[model samples]
Target: MKLTLRLGKRLNRSWQVDAMLMLLLGVFGAFMAIPLIYVINNAFKPLDELFIFPPKLFVRNPTFENFGDLLQVMKGSWVPFSRYIFNTFFITAAGTAGHILLASAAAYPLAKHKFRGHKVLFTIIVLSLMFSPHVTAIPNYMIMSSIGWIDSYKALIIPAFAFPLGLYLMKQFMEQIPDALLEAAKIDGASEYRIFWQIVMPLVKPAWLTLLILMMQMLWGADGGSFIYSEQLKTMHFAMGQIIQGGIARAGAGAAVAVVVMIVPIVTFLLSQSSVIQTMASSGMKD
Candidate 1:
């Protein structure tokens, strides 16, 4: 039997090379973990240690005072800290769910079915990815203002609903689904809706789970931008920024805030990392 050249049998040609590569990977992994370790250590460091001459990688004397300070700062805010937490959760959930559904729905026909102007439509989506979000900020603000969505959660959630990258990823992943599977379902008396919801969507689980990580990172970091004016509507990220900007006194508290803000996105990635790895492995992408 012949083996496919690209399916990774190449890695087994030399055991010594494999051992060397594993060592190399372990070294790189440790390097990558440095920042995460530093953040965790810094958050627990005392205020005095934070200003040491050359700084330290690890905390010599750890303390929970920073977390306590964070709590006090949260309590000092006029808006309840829970409100900011709620707003962040709501926006992240709503935006992520909507983008997944909308992108998956739009991707279905584009991936499996041919239609008029399909190529043109997909071209536009691809083109949109070339521009950074900052380039669209002014236009997005104008649209939000005109729609009276400013100062509301709609300003935050609605703008992220039509994420082009989500659709791009979904469509690419969906293209790998064999059309024969859908045809088999059709022959079994499944409607188009049933085939999509049950067949296509489930097969693309990795794709959306990966998309969830991406969307969570974006929405989790949202800071109300220029649209939100209402104090109650601000996200936890926006509130954290306020707490982080209190100069030298807030240094420890700022480190604590960084840890807090990173929690959700890191957790989301950890939960979905296997799916993401599966998706990437099957993607057949090359450098």
Candidate 2:
């Protein structure tokens, strides 16, 4: 199939094609955004509006009743809402920070240094991505139990450091850094650690920011991954689940919880998505 081209001094695709593509993309984007828009609208909806027969996509009677009701319900719980908030924040902060440092450190050697079994090791990491986390869930649970990490923060934070996709993206992005930079640092008597911390880390800002967004999204929505059995160790996601499961009377409050759950990740993505895209543009080759 041939696309029509027009000459405006230099030849280019016709405006008709560009407009068609944009129209299609606009329609697709609207379709994908419907659920998020519904969630936001439902959060402010009163109980009567929520129970309307032949329910509407948009809220007609918007109010903060849902949030107020949500607060009331949370207050009735055995554990305070603030404790769950702290648990979620701590896990997300620790997990994201650790994953960034460890994945970057691991990627630097794989991208810049030549050593035995390097290709085999990276190939294994790439292949690991093809498998789902559920595949190893049983073994992971057994190991956590045996190691006494169950019902603890370590069970949540430590495993995140070895995230396969994080290492993969970091390594691919690091390959764009020229070897001469590291060589020059070495010639000046810089240790490998010094070269990595001072020389390499500074140049990979975009990559780490990109990884930060990815890891933040993952760890932010985490529900302890079934590893923590204690109520105090549960994250915000677990609290959201409990709220939403409270049957029809609590539906308004549930919507409020859902809205609150969605806000942080969306704000985080809005902040870091540009840097993620910039780094991804150059993350095409591996050394």
Candidate 3:
């Protein structure tokens, strides 16, 4: 497919095929956005509107009663709602930050330096991404159980720091950083640590931001699964699950709870969306 490029410093006429592709993309975007809009609309919809025949796409009569009901439900919980909120935020923040730092650190050497086993090491990491997390759940549980990390934040945070996808993406992005830049820093007497911390990391801001968005979304919605037996250690996602399992009377509140659960990741994405786009656009390119 041929795409029309804009002329330098000026608007240019679009090719007919390019215009058709743009129109198709616009339609696809709208199709993709429907679920998000529906979720937002549901949070404001009354129960009558929710169960109406044919099921309206948008809210007919919006109200805050659902949020009000959600607050009441949360207030009735044996554990304070604030505790659940704290656990969720604490886990998300720690996991996302640690994953970015560790993934980036591990990626740098694999990317810029060719060690004896670098190819095999990177290939292993890439292959690890092929298996779903569920495939290793039993092993993870056994290890966590053996190490006594079960029911603790460490079970969630520590494992996240070694996420292969982050390392793979970070390594790929870092490979795009020219070797001459690192050599220049070395010639200026920059220590390896200084080169990595001050020079390399700043240059890969877009890649790390993309990782932040990815990790934040994954870790934020974590329900602690089998690893967390303690209620106090549970995340907002767990609480949301509980609310959603409520019968029809709780429908409105469930929508509100869904909104609460989704907002953080959406906000994080919005903040770094441009950087993510840039990283994704050029990630396949190399020096």
User: Of the candidates shown, which would achieve the greatest TM-score relative to the real structure?
Assistant: 1
Q: Rank the candidates by TM-score, best first.
A: 1, 3, 2
Model 2 poorest 10 in a row by lDDT: 1-10
- Displacement of residue 275 (Cα, Å) in model 2 is 0.8
Which has the better TM-score: candidate 1, or candidate 3? 1
| CA shift of 198, model 2, Å | 2.6
What clash pairs does model 1 have?
Answer: none
lDDT of 2 by residue, 130-191 (tens): 98988988888899899999999999899898889999988988888888878898899999
lDDT of each: 0.92, 0.88, 0.91
RMSD of each: 3.1, 3.0, 2.6
lDDT of 3 at 218: 93
> Model 3, residue 1: what's the lDDT?
45
**Candidates 1 and 3: which is better by lDDT?**
1
Q: What is the lDDT of residue 73 in candidate 2?
A: 87
Q: TM-scores of all models?
A: 0.94, 0.90, 0.94
lDDT (C-alpha) at residue 56 in model 1: 91
lDDT of 1 by residue, 1-287 (tens): 23236665562346666688899999999999999999999999999999997989999999999999999999999899999999999999999999999999999999888999999999999999999988999999999999899999899898788999999999999888887878899999999999999998998899999999999999999998598988988999999999989999999999999999999899889999999999989785432
Question: What residue runs in model 2 are displaced by over 4 Å at the alpha carbon?
Answer: 1-21, 285-287
Q: Estimate candidate 1's alpha-carbon lDDT, on a 0 to 1 scale.
A: 0.92
